[model samples]
Every structure is written in structure tokens, then in C-alpha cells.
Target: MRLPSTAHTSRPWRIHGIAPDFRVEDVWALPTPGGPDDLPHLVGQFTEGEEPGMAGSSFAYRTLFAVRRRLGRLLHLDDADGGVGGRVASLRDRLPADLLAAPRGPDSDALPFRSVYLLHDEWAAELANRTVHAVLHLGWVPDGAGGYRGQMAVLVKPNGLLGAAYLLGIKPFRYVVVYPGLLRSIGRRWQETAGRRK
Candidate 1:
């Protein structure tokens, strides 16, 4: 479910230290509820399939993704020179000594995002292109019940006016189509995995 910005901002996330300049674009409460020790398992949920994210089994999302990719290609939005370590620095460069030494999360071949760090309760990945530099922050948090559930927040630092405009243009689509469909897929996947374990 979509959450208020305070849901993410109120937490004392390590992300605040490094990407203070970035703005929180969206926050969501994920459906994967579990015990305290199950936080790390959330990573496996996303990485299990050939496609690494919420595009699975959703024709609308798949179509939108394809359209965006085609647009990106034609516009040179994702060219190597416009990506991480090119247009903007990787968040990894800003990591503190201890986190730098800890286990970074797995990298995905299908996704442009690269894992920044994997903490006991939080995980972060980043992607940058000509349009913007963005972070995908996932955390395990109390669900107001005894169990814990995954939460997601997207943070972004726009490149310029064009980037800002692009984000603005997509706000309706993100809320109406992208996030709702994605969250539903995530919920279904979480349930399927839980069922398999029984």
C-alpha cells in the first residue's frame, strides 16, 4: 500500500547520511510479513526469477516498461556516459567505513540497479541515468502487529529541469498503474513463496 512520506522519513535510515540531497519520491508498505529474523529473506523474493522486479505476470507493466525502454534508447537517456559513475557518483562512494566492509547485496543482471548495502533490516540499490539518480530503499519494519513487513521508498536526485519534468509527467501513471500493479504482483509472489514452504 502507498504510504506517507513520513513513513520513510521518520525512520533513522542510514540513507539519510549519504543521500541527504535526494528527495523521497514515494513510500510503500509491502505485503511480505514475517518474523524479525526473516528480513534478509526478502532479497530472495525479488531475485528468484529471470525478471528481477514487479513486471512479472502484469501485461500493463510489461508494456509500459517496454515503451520506456524504447524511449530511453531513442533519447539516449541510458547511455553509458549518463549512468552511475559517469553522470553522477555512485552512493557506494559515500559509504562509511563499517558499511563499506559489510556484505553488499547481490547485483542483478536484468536490472540496471546495483546493490549498495545489505543491513539486517534494510537494503538499498541504486540506478542513475541522464534523467536522474535514484535509490530503491527497502526495510523490514513493524506492521503495527506482532510481525514485521517489508517497506519500500524511492529517493531521487533529478539531473535538471528535464529530469524533474520527466518525474512530474509520470506521477499519475506511477500512482494509477505502476505502483498498484507492482504491489499486487509483490503480494502474490510473497504468498506463493510462503505456500511453497509449507
Candidate 2:
């Protein structure tokens, strides 16, 4: 999806020091196309609610919570009574603390932001070894401004070394570029969804 040029022209969001206060409400492993060892792999969402907006103003908090629940189930192999909780916990620990911070309101003292950490490490080396392409979509419910709603999707195709380095914390600069695009895509998707619903 192409984003609005105006959105691109503006200043981008930045993540300085990690948020001192944050919690991992949930996590899960994304399913590979075939089995557990597929090359193009993905992990589940670490946070529980909506993502940040393009203009850095608003978001859909509840929908993200619901998505995490559903992703949790999918990663659990549909066995609600099984090891899902453990899997989520394990993955949650690997995420950056800021990514797990509580969602802030548009006017709150906190900055409006959201993030996901994708890793291709020794534990899941197969994913890191391949040329993987990934995209994350976050549903949003715009605060007020009528019944309009939307979604934000971040698509990434990190080269093998860069991708692996990102997961390892050896390279953090790439996120600076990646996140703004994510915010923009999310805002556009939310706007389109809201327009269609009306």
C-alpha cells in the first residue's frame, strides 16, 4: 500500500531511551508457511493493544488487544490449555522494553507509539538464514472523529545480515526508518477502513 506523500514529508518518530515502565501482556510465534522450520518465519505481537498513528495523534487500542489474543491462540497450535502461555512469556522477554510500554492516549504525557521486534537468532536460525519478507498490520479505532476506523501495516524486507543484526541489537538505526513507514501505513489503513464502514 502506498502512503500519502505528505505523511512522508513530515518529521519521523524517534525512540530514544527505552521506556522505564513497560509490561509484556502477551507473545506468540508466527507460523511458518509449511512447518516449524520454514524459512520465512514470524513471531507474534508482543504488545496487547493498538499501534501508533501516522501523525502520531491517535490509535485503535482495543482492536490490538483482540489481535494479540487471536495471535496467541494461533501460536499455541489452537490448544488453549497447552503451552501458549509459556511461549508468549519466552518471546516477550526478548522484546525491547519500549515496545511493550502501555499505550498512551493522544493527549497523554507519553508519546503515542508501538513497535514489534523480529528476531532471527540461534534459537530460530532458519528464519535468519533466509531472505525473508514480513509485514505487520495493526488495527485501529480512531478516538472520536465519528465512527471512522483504520489499520496500520508495516512491511519489511531486511537483508539477511541487517535483519539478523537488528534482532541481535547490533544495529538499531534501521528501526528509525522502518517505524515511520509503519505508522503511515497504519494510519492509511485505518482511514480506509473507517471510510468503508460509513
Best by lDDT: 1
Task: Score candidate 2 by TM-score against the native.
Answer: 0.23
lDDT of 2 by residue, 1-198 (tens): 334423212212121112112211112121111222211121111122333332343234334434644864665422423222322222234445654463321221121122333222111101111222232322322224343222233333443574444444522322344344444544454344433332
How well is each residue in 1-198 modelled by candidate 1, as lDDT tens digits?
A: 889999999999999998999999999999888878666667766555655345465777778788999999999999999999999889999999999998899877667888999999988989999999999999999888898999999999998999999999989989977888878877877787785433
Whole-model Cα lDDT of every candidate shown, in order: 0.86, 0.29
Per-residue lDDT of 150 in model 2: 29
Give me the displacement of residue 1 in model 2, in angstroms. Answer: 8.1
How much is 120 displaced in model 2, in angstroms? 27
Q: TM-score of every model?
A: 0.94, 0.23
lDDT of 2 at 127: 11
Q: Candidate 1: deviation at residue 27, Å?
A: 0.2
Candidate RMSDs in Å, in order, are 1.7, 17.1
